[model samples]
Target: MSRRSSKIEFVGSQGVPLVARLDLPEGTPWAYAVFAPCFTCGKDWLAAARICRGLAERGIAVLSVDFTGIGESGGDFADSTFSSDVDDLVRAADHLRENFAAPSLLIGHSLGGAAVLAAAHRIPETAAVATIGAPAEPEHVVHTFGGRREEIERNGEAEVSLGGRVLHIRREFLDDISAQPQAERIRRLRHALLVLHSPSDETVGVENAQRILDAAGHPKSFVAIDGADHLLTDRADARYVATLLAAWAGRYARGSVPAGPA
Candidate 1:
C-alpha cells in the first residue's frame, strides 16, 4: 500500500461549517475524485477510507467529507435534507478546485451515489459517476422517517436510530427528499456511469441497480459483485471496486494533475 497524506478543512455551507478530509498522494499531483459515503457515514468509514486509499495509490487525489450531521461535521442531521447533502458536495468540489485540479470523478455510495448523479451536471469536469449499493430513488430513504412523521411535523424533529447510531430527523429534511425526482434526474444524467451492485445486497435491493441502469443512456456499464454485501467490507470486494474505477476513469478523466509544489 502506498502512503497517503491527509488534511482536514472546515468549510462553510448552509450557515454551518462542514469537516472534510482531503487525501492525496505525497509530493505528486494526480487526477482528483470527490467521494461521498452513505447516509450516516463519515469519511473515515471503512469503505470510504479504503476507496480513498485505493484511488490515491493510483495517483489520484480524493476529497472525502462528512455531511452536516454525520461524523465530525457540524449541524444537526435532522436539520439536513437530500438537497442539503448535495449542497455539501458542491462545497467540497469547489474547495478542491481551488487547491487541486478539477475533479475527474464523482463517486458516491448508497444515498451518496444518488447525490453524485444529481450533482454531475453542476460539476462539468467530472468524467464519470460511480455508485455502490445505491438506491434508485431519492425518496427511497423516506422509510427512515417511519412512525415519526407525526412527531417530526408536530414537534419539528424526531430522533431515530440507524445503523446502531441515533440521529435526529427534521421535517425539512423529509420534505426535501420527498420533493426530489431522483429517478428522472438519473435518467437524464449526461455522464458515463458505472453502476456497481451485489446480488446479495440486503440494504438496497439489487433491483435498484437495474432501475438506474435502465434509466441511464448509453456509455453506461453495470457490474455485479456476486457475493459482496452492500458495504463491500471484504478486502477482495473493495479492491475490485478500486480496480474497476481506475480502469473506467482512465478512459474519460481529464489530464493528470500538476506536480505538487517542488
Candidate 2:
C-alpha cells in the first residue's frame, strides 16, 4: 500500500502552465483518475491531498491539478470562467493520455464536481464520474461574489474576498457560469454517475445532489456523508470518501482498461 507522488505541469486550455501532482501506487495502478478540487481551492489542499493519496493506496493513480490562475498555476484569475475550467479538465485528460494512460475516472469536489460533469463528454475514455458536494448548476458558486455580483456586472470586474483571499471577479466569468445548461449536461452524461453529499453541508445543500441524480439516467448512485462538512476537514471523513470512491469507480474502470503505469 505504499505510494509515490510527483509534481507535473501541463498547458491549460488557456495556454498557461498548470501545476499538478500525480499520486501513484507502489505497483501498476488498476485505473487512473483525474481529481478536481473545490472552487478556489488548490490541488494540495488538505482534503484533496488526502483523497488522492488514499485513492492511490487503494490502487487508483490520481492526477490532481490547479486550474488556470489558481494555486501555483500561471494565469489571471479574473479571466478564468466555468467553461474554461471544463476545457482545462479536458486538457488534463489529454496530458494523461499522451504521457501515461487515459484517465477512466473523473472525481470532483464542490464546484469541481459540476466542472467534471460538464467536461465528461470530451473525455471519451472516462467510464465513471463521481462528484463530492457538487452543485446542480455552475452558477451556484456565484453566491461567493456576494453583493459584488452587481458591481462586477456593472463595472466589468471587482475584487472579492473568497476563502480569505482577494480574487477578481469578472463579468465574463459570471455570464459563462450562468449560461451553463447544467440540467441538460447531467441528463446527457454518457458515463456512470456517483453523487456524494453531506446532509449538514452549509456551503452546498444536499438537495443539489438529489437534483443531479434526478437529471442523470440509470447507473447513477448517491451516498450521504452524514456529519461531514462541505470541505471534509476531518481526516477520517476524507479517507472514507476516498475509499468509497475507489471501490465504486473501480467497478466501472478496471474492466475497461489494462493495469499498467499511470
Q: Give the RMSD in angstroms, all C-alphas superposed, for model 1.
A: 2.6
Runs with alpha carbons beyond 4 Å of true place in candidate 1: 153-155, 256-262
- Stretches off by above 4 angstroms in model 2 are 260-262
lDDT (10s digit) by residue, model 1, range 231-253: 87887888788888877877766
Alpha carbon deviation, residue 171, candidate 2 (Å) = 0.2
lDDT of 2 by residue, 73-174 (tens): 999888899999999999999999999889999999999999999999999899999999999998999987789999999999999999999999889999
In candidate 1 the C-alpha lDDT for residue 154 amounts to: 91
Instruction: Show pairs that collide, candidate 2.
Output: none
Q: Please estimate how well model 2 matches the true structure, expressed as its whole-model Cα lDDT.
A: 0.92
TM-score of 1: 0.92
Cα deviation of 59 in candidate 1 (Å)?
Answer: 1.6
**Each model's Cα RMSD:** 2.6, 1.6
